[model samples]
Every structure is written in C-alpha cells, then in structure tokens.
Target: MPQPPIPVAVLTGFLGAGKTTLLNFLLKDPFLADAAVIINEFGDVGIDHLLVERSDENVVEMASGCLCCTIRGDLIDTMHDLLARRGRGEIKAFNRIIIETTGLADPAPVLHAVMSDPGLLATCRLEGVITVVDAFNGMATLDAHAEAVKQVAVADRIVLTKVDLLEGREGEDMLFAIIARLRKLNPAARLLTTHRNEATAERLFTMGLFDPTKKTPDVQNWLAAEAYATGEKRGRRHAHHGHHHHDHHHDVSRHDEHIRSFSFTEANAISPQGLELFLELLRSYHGANMLRMKGIVKLADDPSSPVVLHGVQHVFHPPVRLAAWPDADHRTRLVFIVKDIEKPMIEGLFKAFTDQISGGADAFTDTTLSLNR
Candidate 1:
C-alpha cells in the first residue's frame, strides 16, 4: 500500500507575536516527538533556526526526535530537498511537518505554494494554519498591518500569547477588547491562550478533515460553517442599521473592517457544470481579494457523495469527493474569507450560474459580473 501523505501545518504571526516561543514550547512536548520543523527566514543569515535550541548543520536532530532545518532557497525547492534527503536516509523519519513562516510574511503565498505544488501534494497534505497573536500588542498589530488581519482570518487555530502581561483594569479591558475583535475577524477559528497552557500540540495539530483521536471525519469542526453563518447574519444586521461606533477601539480596528467572513448555503443540489463556472468566474474576477474559500458541495448528479473544495486565492486543491455525507445535513455550504468583496456579489454570481444550469440557459455567454458595483 502507498504511504499516506504527511500532514503539514503552517505557523504564522506578526513580529513579536511569540511564534518562536510557542514553537519552542510545543517542540518540548512529547506529543510532537515525530514532528519535523522547517524554519523560513528572509535574509541570508537566518536567526530563527539557530534560536530553535538545536544547531549543527542545515538539518539538526533534536533530542525530542524532531528534525529542524532552514529554508535554503525558495520554499518549493526546500521542501523537495527535504523529501529527497529523507528518502535517502539522511534525516530522521517524521510524520508531521511544521513550517514556521517569517514574521512579516503574508502566509497566502506559503499556502498557495503548498496547495498548488503537485509533488508536495502526493507526499504531504496541508493540515492547518496556526496563527499566534500577541495579546499585549495584537490590537496595534492588527490595526497597522493588513497581513496580521489576514493571518488571523485564515487560521484554523488562533493562539493568544503573553496574556500574563495583561495586568490591572486597563490591561484587562484591552484583553477583552482584543478577544472580541479577534472573534469578529474570524469566528470559526478556535481561540486559545498560551498563558493558561491551552495551546498544546494535541490542540494545534490534527486540525484537518480527519480527527486522529476520534478516528472519524470531523466535518463540523473542520468547516465551522455555523459560526460563519452566525457572523454573516450579524454582519448583515450591522450593515442594515448603518450604525457606526466612533471610538478609539473602532478606529484601531480599521483593517478588520475590510475583511468579510461569511457563509453561503444552498438547500438544494447544484449542477457540476454550474459549480465549475461559478468557481472559474470567482477566481478570474476577485481572486486576489479572496483570502480563503472552503465548502462542501451537494452535486445534483451525486447528491449522496459530496465534493469538498478548498482554495487560497486563485489556487485551489483538487476537489475530493467523499463516499458519504459526514452528517445528516446534505445542503451545500461554502464559507469565504475575503477582502473588500461583498457577500451579495458572490451569492448573486453563484445563483446566476446555478439557475442557468438548472434552467438550461447559456450561463457562460449571457451572464455579466462587475466588481465595481
């Protein structure tokens, strides 16, 4: 039997977000003994790899049975080299790979590289993204950096670090406000605190479709579609009222304003051709603005077996059809995290295509979409 693909997790955060600190803590834990780490740095002289508590050569063997290496060139070449060495018995065998991105990195390109690479796809699967947020400076970071907001928006798990520094009543208020802001940005992500020892390897990893501990597909946890649905409704209500709370807190959260996380659900099955046309038009028109999109589709032809779609920007993973529905719910659900793209535009485009497919109209030639509106 062919070996199953290894799970690859991306660890991202803004500068001084304590990503390295959290990584050090996780590396010491016994659960990540078989994990391999790839630390990516921008400059020629990499400091994060040296700071990882293991040093010797390009690939360092840790006492905890984890292999540590720095990116030699681009990420694609580096991953290929690592796999080559592992196949040649040059490094220890590891079941999991953790990629520590640079503090200033956007993380979308990193995900695009991983998801679009065919060679890597055969050997590895993207497990999830774990973004570390500094509780002390997270508010400011999110305000100043759009990248920081995108990091939190695309994360499967959000780890809040340096919570112990939040002292006094003012600090407590700041903590609560930041937490609320984070939930507003990405409600589906599981918020965790590092100070309380809540950010562990067990909680961080295995965040993909399959839950190893439960020995079953955790679709609800993976998608968290309900959370996005609730957030979408709340957003609509806020937009309808046209209420703006002009305050220091709201001013500092300017970046969060551009980000829109919402879910699009369909009660009936959709035609495969319609879904294809919808995705193509979406990618062509607003791929750059689309931060992330994940959904399970109920096909009109194969309603019993649903197809799951995951994408980062224009690059999307090959559609995988599950043998059966994970739960009783068979409706099509798609969750989107985008920047400056209105929910109405996406929903309208999808409806047009699906309606054309069902009504036997010329969807591709007749339909017109404009991002300006």
Candidate 2:
C-alpha cells in the first residue's frame, strides 16, 4: 500500500522574528509526537539550544520530545534520507514533517520544489506556512526588505513575537500600527500575538486542505473572505489610524501603499469555463502584481458545492471542490493581496472575463496604485 502524503509545513520569518521560539513551542505537542522536524541552518547560526542530543553529526533529538535535524546539504536529499531511515526503522516512524527555513530564505522556491518534485509530491504535501513577526522591528523590517513582505504575504498564520516589550500608551500605539500593517499585507491570514505565552500547536499545525487527522478544510477560517468583504476591515484600519491620530502623531503603518488587499463578491454562480478564463487572464497579465489570491467560487454547474482556488504569484495550485458550501451564504467571494496593483483593475478584468463581479472598490483608489512613492 502507498503511504499517505505527509504534510510538511514551512515555518519562516525574518532574522530575530522568533520562529525558533515558535518551533520549540510546537515540538512539545503530543499530536506532533511522531513528527520529524528539518531545521535549515543559514550562514553560521548555532542551534545548540534546540538540540538535546547530537546523535548524528547533522541530526539531533530534542529534549523537548521531538526529532530535529539540520539540513547539511540539499533539502531534497535530506528529506529522502529521512524517509529511507524511517523505512529501515533506523529513526522513529514519524507521520508528519515540519521544515524550518532560514531567516532570509525565499519560501516560494521551497513551495515550488514540493509542488514540482514527483517524489516529494507523492510523499510530502506542502501544508501551512507560518510566519513570525517581531513586534519590535517588524515595521522596520518590512520597510527595508521585500523578502519580509513576501513572507508575510504568503503566510497561512502570522505570529507577532516580542509583544511583552510593548508597554505604555506609546507602545500600545506602535502595536496597533504593526497589526494594521500586517492586516493590510494579509487580511485573510490569521494573526496571533505571543510574548511569553505558548500558542497551541494544533492551531498552527493544521492549515492545509485536510489536517493530520484527515478533517475537512476549515473554509471559513482559511479563506476569511468575509472579513475583507464586510466593512469590518475598514473599521479596523480606521481604528488603527485613530489611535495614532488621537495623539496628533503621523500614522507610521502606512509605510507602503503598493501592497494592499481587496475583495469582490459575485452574487450569481460562475460557469466553470468562465472562471478558468478569468484566472488565466489574471495570471497572464497581472501575475507579477498579484502576491496571493484565494477564493471559494460557486460553480454555475453545481451551486451546491464550491470550488476553492489558491494562487501564489502566477502559479496556481490545483483547484479543489469541497463537498458543500462552508455556509448558507455562499456567493463567489475572492480575496486578493497584491503589490502595485489597483483593485479596480482586478475588478475590471474580472468583469471583462465573466461579467459577474460588478461594482468597484472605493477604499483602494487608482491614485494609491499610481503613487510613485
């Protein structure tokens, strides 16, 4: 019998963003008791604290009750060796895999590798992407590095670390700004703040199509298109600005107008072909502009079930049709987190292809996209 695809989640963040802290927290879970963690060592960073036993030159078993090994060379090779060892019962038979990427590494390529590799595709599934953000330096990091921006944009979960450092009214104001900034970058992604408390591994671990337990996708929390469609998002944004504005201080969160999020809903069900055409066109012309796109579409042929689509950059993962709509109020809701792209253009292009998504975005104006700065 063939082995089921093992879910592999990539935990990433900028340097000093506390991914290591989160990883340590996650390894303590009983659910992940039989999981193999592959940690990527970049440059000369020492991870002696993470490993309790250096049984092998590269691999070590953590005292926190998990197996961890540093990727000494090729990631693919390391994974292959892991499976081979497990097959021979040399190592424990772990059912799950967690990959901790280097701080500055581009996570897209790691995702692409799993998607493209025939062997990894059959054995390992690219599951959730968890990105940690430093409450102290997150804003500065985003302003300075595009890599950091991309990490936030692609994450399934954003964990804000070092919030204990935030104190007083001034600190409170700064926290709001960073939260707002993260919201703008990825509204659909779930945000959790952790200073010293340990976040549940179950909450962060299972974010893919199905969890390790084989449960159905949590469409509501996963897509969260409603959060963007409703006025709640705008209210939250204004609330953030309100805090800074109350003190007569400038809003430091609006660092980059290029990266923004918007959503559009179509009342009528969309034909399968028409939906495909719109996506193709979107990816062909404005793919570079799109950072991430996800939606649960109501198919014209079968309105009873919804088709879920998720795309990163130009490359779209295979569309999956859920057994039923997540809720009763399932119209086609698509959310986009993009860079240097106006909402009107996407809405207009969507209209051109399907004539389904009507109306334009009021909050994200053309001027914001056209601004040189």
Candidate 3:
C-alpha cells in the first residue's frame, strides 16, 4: 500500500521576528516529535542551524526525536536526499516537514518550489504558511520592506512575537496600531499574540485543506471568505471618499498600500472551459502581481461537487474536486491577495469569460483586454 503524503509547513518572518524561538518552542511539544525541519540561511555560516539543539553533524536528531538539517544546495535536491535517506533507513520516518526560511527571503519562491516540483508534490503536500511578526518593529518593517508585507499577505497564521516587551501606554498604543495594520493587510489570516500564550504548536501546524482534529473539510477557516468580503466593502468605502483617512500617518514609501485582499462570489455555476480561460488570462497578464489566489469553484457540469483551486503567481496546483460541498453556501467563492491589481479588473475578466461561454458575444476584444495597473 502507498503511504500518505506528508504535510509541509513553511515558517517565515522578517528579521529579528523570533521565528527560531517559536520553532524551538514548537519542537519541544510532543505533537511534533515526528516532524522534520529544514532550515535555510542566506550566508556562508548557518547561524540558525547552530541555534537548533542537535545530536549529529548532517542530519541532527533533536532531543524531542525531531530531525533537523541545514540546506547546503538546492531545496529540491535537499528534500530528495532526505526522502532517499529515510527510505534507506538512514533517518527516522517523519510525518511532518517544517521549512524555516531566512528573514529577508520572499516566501513566494519557496512556495513555488514546493508547489511546482512534481517529485515533492507526489510525496508531500503544502500544509500552510506561518508568519512571525515583531509586535514592536512590525509596523516599521512593513513600511520599509515590500518583502515583509508579502510575508503577512500569504500567511495562514500570523504570530506576533515580542509582545511581552511592549509596556506602558505608549507601547500599548503601538501594539494597537500594528494589529490594525496587520488586519488591514490580510484579513483572512488568523492573528495570534505570543505574550498571551496563544502561539502554540498544535494551533500553528496542520493548517491545511482539512482539519485533522475534526476530520472534516474546514473550508470556512481555510478560506475566510467573509473576512475578505468585509474588507473589500471597507476598501470601496475608503476609496469613494477620495483619500484613505486611516493612512495619513503612514510614510510615502509604505508598501502596504500596494497590497489588496478581496473576495467575490459567483452565484451561477461556471463551465470548465470558461474557468480555464479565466485562469489563463490572469496568469498570463497579471501573474507577477498576484501573491496568492485560492477558491472553491462550482462547475456547471457538476454543481454538487466543488473544485478547490490554489495558485501562487503563475504556478497553480492541480485542481482537486471534493466529493461533496463542504457547506450550504454553494456559490463559487474566490479570495485574492495581489499587489497593484484591483478587484474590479478580476471580476470583470471573470464575468466576460463566463458570459462568452454562455453564448454571449466575444468579450476578449482590445477594449476589454486593456488593463490599467
């Protein structure tokens, strides 16, 4: 019998965000005893790898039975070597894999590598992205670095570290501002504060398509479409007023303004061809700006069985069709996290393709093809 695919979770954050500390905490938990860790550093000497307590040289066995290794070459090659070694009885078989990326790295490439690699995909599936944010410095980092904003934008869970350092009224005010900014950047992600003892291993991992504890499809928690929908309305209202009143305190170089998170629902079922064309247009035209896109699509041929679509930039995983609808909300819902791409453009493109498939006039003419930002 074939073994089930292991879930791979990517842990990322900005510089000094305490990701290593969080990892140490998680490794101490009994639930992650069978987990394997791959640490990626951007220098000649791997400091993070040394920080992790280990027993051996190459594949260090953690005190908790978790295996840890530092990436010396290509990520794909390293993963393949690990799998081969495990097969040859060189290492213990780990049920979970956690990749800790360097602070300055853009997680999109990491995600692309895991999602696009055929070999890795066959044996492993993406669990989710967990991002660590420094409560004291997160706002400043996000204002200056586009990479930090992307980290939070693509996260399934946002862990705010260093909250214990914040004291007095001034610190309280800073924490409030940072939390508000984080929520605006990515409304779908679950936010947790370290000071409150909320960032636990059990709560952080296993954030995939299915809830292992419930043994059911957790579409609502995964998608959080309602949160994005609410954010979209607020954005429109802010835009209609001519200026963002809440953004007056921000600097001109703030990258958060470029990021947008929104969601839309299609009441009618979409044909397969229409869906294909729509996705193709988005990927071909604006894939670079698209940070992430995920949705449960309702097909015209089989409305009862919805298909889940997930993509990072131009690379998309194979659409998986669920056996049945996860909830009564049968409408096709999609959530998008993009930079410099507005919600109207996506909505218009989708409508045009679906309408054309429904026997309407060709909507792919130059006039409709014209894209603004």
TM-score of model 1 vs. true structure: 0.90
Can you write out model 2's per-residue Cα lDDT over 281-315, one digit (the tens) per residue? 67777777777787888888999999988777777
lDDT, model 1, position 305: 94
Candidate 1 lDDT, 14-104, residue by residue in tens: 9889888888789888989988889974234433443444435677777677887888879888888888888887777888889999889
Residue 310 error, candidate 3, Å: 0.7
Best by TM-score: 3
Per-model TM values vs. the true structure: 0.90, 0.80, 0.91
* Candidate 2: segments with Cα more than 4 A from true spot: 1-4, 42-47, 50-60, 72-77, 80-90, 196-198, 230-255, 355-373
Query: Worst ten-residue run, lDDT, model 3?
Result: 42-51
lDDT of each: 0.83, 0.75, 0.83
Per-residue lDDT over 1-373 for candidate 3, one digit per residue giving the tens place of the 0 to 100 score:
8677788899999988988888877888999998888997424433344344544565777777888887877888888888878888888899888999989989998899888898888888788999999999988899999999999999999999998788998899889889878888998898998887898888998578843445457787789999998877766676687364444477779998889999998877778887897888889888999999999998988899999988999988778788899898998889999999878888877766556345444554432547633
Worst 10 residues of 1 by lDDT: 42-51
Q: Clashes in each model (backbone N, CA, C under 3 Å)? A: 0, 0, 0
RMSD per candidate (Å) reads 3.2, 5.2, 3.0
